[model samples]
Target: MTGMEPLAPLATAGRRIETAIIGGGQAGLAEAYWLRRAGRECVVFEARKRVGDQWRERYDSLRLFTPAWADGLPGMTFPAPRSSWPTAREVADYLEGYADMIGGSLWAGVRVDSVEMLGDGSFVISTTSGQWHAQNVVVATGSDAAPKIPEVASQLDPGIRQLHSSQYRNPAQLLPGPVLVVGASQSGADLALEAAQAGHETWLSGRHPGELPVNERIAGPFFWFAQNYVLTLKTPIGQKLRPVIRHGGSPLIRTKRADLDRAGVHRTPARTTASIDGRPTLDDGTVLDVANVLWCTGYLPSYAFIHPAVIGPDGYPTETQGVAADVPGLFYLGLVFQRGFYSHLLGGVGRDAKFIAQLISERALSRNTVAA
Candidate 1:
């Protein structure tokens, strides 16, 4: 969809809406786009002061692994060249621009405190700002809510500077000394390389999570292949691999193995398990005397505000393709493999948004007809 399209009207703060979408990132924005397209009155409640604060808050050198053309949501295309990988700031800015273009009921800084289903079958969305009523609620908060720093990290010395991937902004944030980075996934590799390039001695410690078969320079073919064959649940291979992908972290995508080697970042095979006498210790009993540690350990699914039934004991929401079969009118988007592998991605959210929007529209129409 063209970004030039006429924007829908913005929602007034404190007003009750028919549908309430939590989070104003790409997923929530995509949901809002489709909901508005179906003539549904919805309001997006963002916790951050701005729409793309999530991306803005990431590390300084972070960029989209995919090209610009592959990073668009519903009703808008990212404004960068098709093949160019946009920096984190660029992607964040694009999201803000996309929200402006949509102009559809986005309420930034309205953090959702709790979501409870009322006895009357409607939902009461309580936020930091105020309470709002909605016939339907879509949790588009995306997958990354809580940073997954291990409990053992606290055992480290107070003098040592340790930061999670979410808390990391730039190499300058680290103390002046050798840096130890845990987790050998894309984020770990990226941070190690960046630290090395910034003239810091960097040691990357963790199990190698494997790498993508394709190179990073030309991501188009690999993207097409994965989207078509690997990511989709319809395929037999995808069905078999879905469970693995869900449980395991994705292989290195953005950072290549050669890139890390070229940057002179030392690679260690053991994971950093804990600290031994103020020094970080590896799983193999090796203690590292690094001044800084960056935990690229990824995040956990945190939907604690939702009802227990909506979320399984595993902490993940139980839903089928964005639709809540158990809880009618309660849907989810931006979850990993919600429908496909790209469900949490920018381009993929739009497809799920289209499906969820249709379901919501139908339910609303049915209720109106019953009332009539």
Candidate 2:
């Protein structure tokens, strides 16, 4: 009725389980679902105060790129119409309902501080609430854990308002003047279009990742083809294209080039290459004097809380399709390209989670037999 209903707290001190899933978003919830079917005891630790706060915390103008029918986790289908493009609030509500329906082991308001592997091939999770010893640890914290803003931001004048896309809630959150949105990713394009629509002189800068044939609106037979075929990494061509898309960023799926043109949003070079006299400078030597700047440059994967040995020098966990190699009981979920192209998407996380659940179950069976 008011704020989110707080999750009943668990006794955090010395809790032990078969698995510990971090970050109670789609990835963690999906893991919990299949683990329950396997009768594996697991717990989810969410940093947010509420169940669906992750999606709810994003920008105000956000909507799911995928159709509602394709956005569900393992067993729970999203309740909206199949063709509908759900709002961020709808997604948030759906996640909350999903959590409630599953009734799995979850601890909200608990921030995972550190995860360490013991010599006995087990993991110890340290959190704001308490400690947990888990036989297996699944890092489902997702790709958006840390916002990546360039160091050049410090060079800008203090008079020009600047914030990462994560911090942006709406156009009203920005100062009244020309708005500069850096990064041509979906978030950047959508925000730029929104700013322009709101009467702000908006400039969008970044390398175009290209646009999808269909968006949330005016989707037809092409929508099904794009969703079920082209975007999936299971195909040979899709596999070959994964690296390019991953490094370049996802193509504009929701906001199209025509939308930007209609909104009168100006385009610039791929990045803010430099700063001149407290103004934003692009790669092509274009200097923009804007009052507000939104950095949609994307997020850095933050696994700092995890031990260095668990992660590669590239800042990713040494995992093959969610199962870590060097660490006996360490696993990862919700990462970009974890297994397939859709791995990070809401619809795709469940498949990866199910696979990981099978691995966890096999290991458990082997251990029990040996002990017997």
Candidate 3:
């Protein structure tokens, strides 16, 4: 479909398409842009009511860790000062604008239920609205979809207000009293600081992932260059650091330990491992009596919609770079450390998208030639 064409109606049966990109976020949109440039027809399926709802749904005070200059996707620059950090709303607005500029077929408010590969290698994508039959399917749904909360959360007092970081909007949602923010990554630190600044006694649980070696503003260009070009799977250090980054989580980008301390946020080195008498218990045997608990524990990869044949034990697709080797035309995008540390970031996803798009275009051409 052309950029000028209206969004195709949802067919309850199955609408055939050349390529179905299973997301409308930065990753999916980038793939669509590259495919369009390659003269390939494609459609983007976005579960949200609108493009960029993912970012908009984050905490109200959320802003990109990277400066605006490093947050734009392919074909468009983020409309903000280069050195400025764009807020969540601004990123969302930019995505919406980028989608409009791309003008590819995008189905909003459509949730894909499942993706099954046929005997012939084509895909059957079942969705809330309808089904789509496509020769190629790019799973660009991103890494952070499902919020990860520990099973011990159920033991917390029912009176205690609990919320995962994803569900938290602002301090207003928190109950009046001391708040315990679990997990000391960027989100945890940010929320803990916010809670403390909001006049609540806040305790930040779990050891931090560490902070940047230098202030990002002072080393913006160098940091960008390292993350984008130097720190890659191709390098020995990048390979060694991959597991630490993937499992331990990225280092604090915006939130620093000093910042948390400055906000009067109590920092705990122990993790919130259990609950005692309806209260949070730390691994160090300290029990925290708080009115609210904010779980900033991060997210798990959710690819349950994908078929078992395509998904691995890690809940991720078995793919190299972005191309699925087992399933010829199946691809994945925006995976953490997919190609490098920046693979899932806005500025970095375009490279993986471009690579996958080229492969898909080449395969399409080969298929057409064979048929002819």
Candidate 4:
């Protein structure tokens, strides 16, 4: 808050900063707030041209399927009743405001190349723009830092006009014909339903019916119970569970059987894998004649900038909460559970950010220094 610059061109080259936040997303912005409140100095490096660019890049029709009550950032709420979940653009605007509140030290569009520990044990974070030195690092780019489109997705017929969920804007932007939506996850089902409702012949392919919501009265405090007691998501055993994680059931906007029927959204059998006679083919050997394909497959977390020595067999930064055994001083927050499952939620990031920020301050800047 004291000494801040808007756009820094490699701060006095080679001058070391105490810490560097490696993202400008929800996690990065949250951490920056805490880092400042704690009287710790740091710089935030964001690869995008502006804050909330990630959300801005999402589909135009996307909304926070999680209720509006869950959309609060550290010190601010969505400002309506708790039920006002924000659209993608609204969230992005909130983040932009957050950046302004934090004094705009976000160096946008500067991508990090590699982060290596020097002989002196400090971190040397090199980027496309320049370099920065920090005693501590927070990798808060979030889970969907990169999209996980399959290699074969590109090999589909050129006439198909394929688009991933990330690139999809609206049905109007799609081809002038029926559309085939692949994957049955929330994105897939929602897109299929939207397409069909927009007067496009839409077919959805998914094996799992996915999870459905419960009546609030009967379910009790399901969210609270799940976060505090259950092992469905971030708990120890659940983390080791399996390749197929339990779905969030249905999103708030339900894509139920009735909804599908009324919307004329057809559900083709699962296992659909290819394009036939220039159309998408279902696993049952049936073909859905269409000119557009929407692949809402999902995203993969990428840690390629991190060297393999610090990575595990799964090719991720092997860390616990914000602590990593192999890589000391390498803390990750706003990840799966620096606090809880809601840690990733807009409202829940403050707790995670505070916790991680406290740890960082203690380890890197505390007057009563405890060895990190």
Best by TM-score: 3
The true-structure Cα RMSD of candidate 3 reads: 2.2
Q: State the number of backbone clashes in model 4.
A: 4
lDDT of 3 by residue, 1-372 (tens): 344343454445477898999999999999989888887888889999999999989999988778888888877899999989889999899999999998858888989999999998899999887788999999999878889999989999999999999999999999999999999987888899999999999999987787777776855566578778777899998888876676656778777888888999989899899999999999999999999999998889888787744666666677788887677888898888888988988888899899998899899989999999
Off by over 4 Å in 3: 1-13
Of candidate 2, the 10-residue stretch with the lowest lDDT total is: 1-10
TM-score of each: 0.93, 0.92, 0.94, 0.86
lDDT of each: 0.82, 0.82, 0.86, 0.71
Positional deviation of residue 95's Cα in model 2 after best superposition, in angstroms: 1.3
Worst 10 residues of 4 by lDDT: 242-251
How well is each residue in 1-372 modelled by candidate 1, as lDDT tens digits?
433344355544456678989989988888888877776788888999987889899998888777878888876788998888888899899899989877756778788988888887888888887788888999999777888887878999988899999999998898999999988887899999999999999999988878877777666558655864577778787777666566555778878778899999889889888778988998889888989999988788887787534676556788887777578889998887777777877767788888988999999999999999
**Order of models, best TM-score first:** 3, 1, 2, 4
**Winning candidate number (lDDT):** 3
Which residue pairs clash within candidate 1? none
After TM-score superposition, the amount by which residue 180's alpha carbon in candidate 2 deviates from its true location, in angstroms, is 0.7
